[model samples]
Target: MNIIDKTDEELLAIGTPWWEDLIKYSNKGQYGKFIQNFSTDLLRGLNEVEVGNQFAKSDLTRSLDTNYDFLGFIRRGEHVSFLFRVRSTKKPGEWLGRMVLGYERGEVKIFAASIF
Candidate 1:
């Protein structure tokens, strides 16, 4: 099924596991596992050194509070951008987390992910 055609609940179901893996691997500083489901374009723009640097320097990327609140999503073209109200396990404020999902070579993959 096309990702963009899925309902909100379905999209959440599809994205939740990937999102969880992202948080889990990120907290562990496992760069490979963290980008396992990333799209080609995303992978092309990232590298272990860059990710490691971010993980080392950014508190938001170091350890995220797993109890994130889903802040709905926006569909644009072939992608669905999911937003979450996230917090840092080591910090004390809310941040916005975004994950954009779409099909790549017939498989669902993350085109982008960020915390701000």
Candidate 2:
């Protein structure tokens, strides 16, 4: 289903703290979710790799970016763990550390993130 048509229950099931209503209206495209949640550098890296897949009409890249091998998720109370890596294509093998997103009270806030 399209973003506008998705039910609140379905959005809540995804387990992010940002309320469905807040997310749905904040950006025209849900693709911006990544940009909204991540840092400028990270977003840039993602853009370079086409992580949001703006060129393609699909959620495949966004989903993968959020839940990848190195990047995983875990639900702990009000917080949903987010884990992911960032590496520059130009740098090749040079990779960055994992990051996490803390969710609480309908807000998907970054609790503690670092370059691991």
Candidate 3:
């Protein structure tokens, strides 16, 4: 799916893999791979809050039980950002996620992911 000059369906397609890979990568403690989904600015922002540790902890602790929801989308100039609402049946809100799709380096990037 295209991020630049994308349709809504394209926007939808753009974020799914990143979310799935986020789970897979985080569970494996592949922090570099996990952060690769984001832009440098987003990475810097998340690090300031130590979210990677929380995400890794959640994934490593409950790798089998984690789940995510496609909550909705947000619009930005030249970007089609989507949100993923993550939940764990074990601890409903502990690892709640809000993720978005935006462009970085001329490609679609899963730019923001935060627990809520």
Which candidate leads in TM-score?
A: 1
Write model 3 residue lDDT over 1-116, tens digit each, in one string.
Answer: 34646666776666777778776666666677778878777766765346555655664333523467677776766556566656554553544566677667776676676555
Q: Show the colliding residue pairs in model 3.
A: none
Off by over 4 Å in 1: none
Kindly list the per-residue Cα lDDT of model 2 for residues 7-86, writing each as its tens digit: 44543454344332222422234454534555344444554445334425433221222212344555555444444454
TM-scores for candidates 1 onward, in order: 0.93, 0.31, 0.68
Of the two candidates 1 and 3, the one with more favorable lDDT, higher being better, is 1
**Tens-place lDDT digits, model 1, residues 11-111:** 98899988888888888888888989999999999876878999788777877988999898999999999999988888999989999999999999999
Q: Model 2 RMSD to the real structure?
A: 11.8
Q: Rate the local accuracy (lDDT) of all candidates.
A: 0.89, 0.39, 0.64
Off by over 4 Å in 3: 1-5, 46-52, 55-66, 93-96
Among these predictions, the greatest lDDT belongs to: 1
Candidate 1 similarity to native, TM-score: 0.93
